[model samples]
Target chain A: MVRSGPYDLNVHCIPESGDTIEEVVAVARRLGYSGIAITNPDSMKQLPFSGNVEGFDILSGVEIRADNASKLHGIVGKYRNKVDIIAVSGGSESINRAAVENPGVDLLVNLNIAQDSGFNHVLAKEASENRVAISFDLGDLIHLKGGSRVQAVTNCRKNLLLIRKYNVPYVLTSNARSCFDMRAPRELAALAALFGMSGEEAMAGLTTIPHSIIARSRPPAGYISEGVQLVYNEADTGNIDEGDR
Target chain B: MKLLPPTLRARTRYLAFEVISQDPVRREDLIRELFSSAGSLLGDVGASECAIRLLAFEGSTGVIRCAHDRTDRTRAVLASISTVKGTRVIIHVLGISGTVRGATIKYLAGVDVFNPKDSHI
Candidate 1:
């Protein structure tokens, strides 16, 4: 069973032009976001201090456009600091290579291509073999040209089935490019229904999976307050965080 | 290619504009007149190809909002405007909106605006 809430794992806040990091942070804070995963291709220098921000847990992450593997993969936390997750930014060969090379990192496969293409099987096998966790994003499926909502739902069901069968880990996200593009938890659940996922399964994608990934990356000291713990506690029990969990 | 519906189709209707004029000495005067006159006119009478809305004119630059539906048409309209009197005109075409702002800058003060194949709409 997975928990449910407003869990947004992928968000890009970098400005279009001259806007600075402070401005970006200010905008994010004003939006009342729970967590923000900063994704700058080159470096994480511009990200605000993760601990300082209020009402949000700032996760350190990066989206690298790797040509050697010809794919985009996000590496969260520093290399020396055991990476929590490695999300596939939609490319097969490169993503596979990154997963294989980075033994400890979990895999977040962006199912951007055809389901019949066998990429899912390959990813499952690789994740199991490497003892790495895995998750998938539905944004790519929705964005595909001539792709139908039914097809997207079917693809997600197939992917989730594979995860269950292979005993691999999984998560869900909107793959948002900007702050305004963020979707509410209910919206994500509705999207899951399009992919043949039950309301519970969809809720898990938003809560449990993301919380699990964050748990893996957290330092020994733990988070700032009991409120954070309450969120995770409710998530573990697959309950809603309406009040104080 | 198959034609998409209005919701999915990227058209000229969604364009928003920002114009910057960098002449510091005439900035305030140009802005006041621009807002009171040209800005009001545009707000009242929308163009066929674009609904021009004056954003801000700071220093010698004035910002205006324009449609991004058709690049060719947008460029054509921008090209027809010759002089900004003495101010340099900088046009910024915003791509994706919200938390992430994707914009492409163009100097309409001089030179012909050319669309590159790799440019994002």
Candidate 2:
């Protein structure tokens, strides 16, 4: 397994203010995130300047939250070719199933945000088959406190246990809305322990799995199926006119 | 009273942490936040047991003394602190060591987060 540092691949929309994205980048870079994907549901286009920053990579992602299967499929088809990671907001049972069943959906995140234990065995199996990584968001822990936090953690642990049992890929994130909400990797690992995730397991979600997802989802080079690239033979391309303009 | 035996005395764990904030941070403010967050998150009993003591603060880095077994709880308490005096700040635990000097040198040697040249404000 590659030992690259963690990447927070699911950050909510950050309002386009004066260099606000810069602030978020600085925080994530300082916190040691090697890569991050800003998942905004409203944005029509990716960040034009999302490139390498002080050795950190900024990836563009889209989040599609739909009320029904048809709408979810429509959004997925629309954004699958546009974003790096196509995330589906999975809170209700219907959405969870739709997200897992759809091959265009790359990430199934926040499955338990709105309800108690929104994910299940069937969803887990489908997600595994579709190669959709589940998200274990630590930002929710910060938003809640006391018994509610405890309950949330408990629900997360339950979901994690099922995800692990089925051997489905999972990812960890702060789900930060702003730069201030970002956290260190160790801090996130410790919080994951509260939800029955071992340190190594949590680190894998933060680093290895996300890394694979990014690698697989990256816009293909000379694009084609895995291991097959469209080769442009020099002889066939020689007839094309070359102009500096 | 006689000194407590080694077996009975609580073991110490030094946590080397970095504070990421927009403004210069005061050591006293960190101490107060630690106690407040610890008290609020873990309650009085848990807070007293952890007994977080600020050993050193240089620039935006610091070493804190916490109970050996309670290191997890102390780290958790520190992570719970989101804002210090209404300014958003992140307390990142670099690592834990048995000696304050070890933690200081290992994680925070010549820490320059609050350096005058690097100051954001």
Candidate 3:
């Protein structure tokens, strides 16, 4: 948490994916990443890694996959307090809209699978207000080839335009399933450039946005909400901001 | 045939990279995949402009030479390469240098020194 890290916010590890969490963390550390979140899809049974790994931050996260909007809300509430971050797997139009509109969601992933940019002006505006980050999976650029690759790139370009227009927060993730699937921050930035994202913007997505998402999940002792918090004086009792409450 | 002057030649940058795979990868297989990756990603003309060449390969580590201005393109080319001859591989770039010796010494020789775990965040 001390580092303004080049963190990969969305990564899948053992039980859900091929590699174990230790293997994934070792590879990430070797590649110079300060931290990574192990976000296995919620539909799958997840084996929690409770103990901390020294010298590296492993933020526990859940990728909630819901068939409908109401189901999405229920899953978010169930896992909200259990994990450091919550991501919604986006595909259908309903799921994408639900994810963006929900304040509990920290990330909206896999929008590339949708027919078009499932994200649009309205969704972007909602996401901006909700502080939900749109995650662009660079793994699509690597794993997909031929026509699909072109389509994924095109979709990302369109999504990026909307994100920029609305000033929405965004993060870049490899969506890695294994140790080999993970990539360095620079390489991810290069892959990002193929879809018209500048290096600076990609770096911010990799470092700044993800860091902020993690920070937001864990506020200070007296924190209530954005811009306002509880205050306590030595001689007096603590007072919560009624407006924020 | 006459050699081109230094100023007329394309400035070269050496990229030091390590290959991570489940199986041992052959240098020949790596070379073939590198070119094909560059070709598929950047197309024929773009690949030719980058002037990519594998300078050296030993075990899992290697140094590649490309036009200095096309480092990002070259990086994309490397990143796009996920497999070689049915084996899944990830080419992780360690560092880049203006000279082959510098790349070898800085990245290949002293990899432990480059470990980010000990570095200030």
| lDDT score for candidate 3 against the true structure | 0.86
Residue-wise lDDT of candidate 2 within B23-87, one digit each (tens)? 87788788888888887777899888888898888788888999888887787787778888876
C-alpha RMSD (angstroms) for model 3 = 4.2
The lDDT-based order of candidates, best leading, equals 3, 2, 1
Per-candidate TM equals 0.49, 0.86, 0.92
Which prediction has more favorable DockQ, 1 or 2?
2
Evaluation by lDDT, superior candidate among 1 and 2: 2
> In order of the candidates, what TM-score does chain B achieve?
0.33, 0.86, 0.87
Mind giving the per-residue lDDT tens digits that candidate 2 earns over A118-140? 78898889988988888888877
Comparing 2 with 3 on DockQ, the higher-scoring candidate is: 3
> Which one is best on lDDT?
3
Clashing pairs in 2: none
Candidate 1 chain A, run of 10 with poorest lDDT: A71-80
State the displacement of the C-alpha of residue B7, model 2, in Å, after optimal TM-score superposition: 4.0
- Kindly report the interface RMSD of candidate 2, rounded to 1 decimal: 4.1
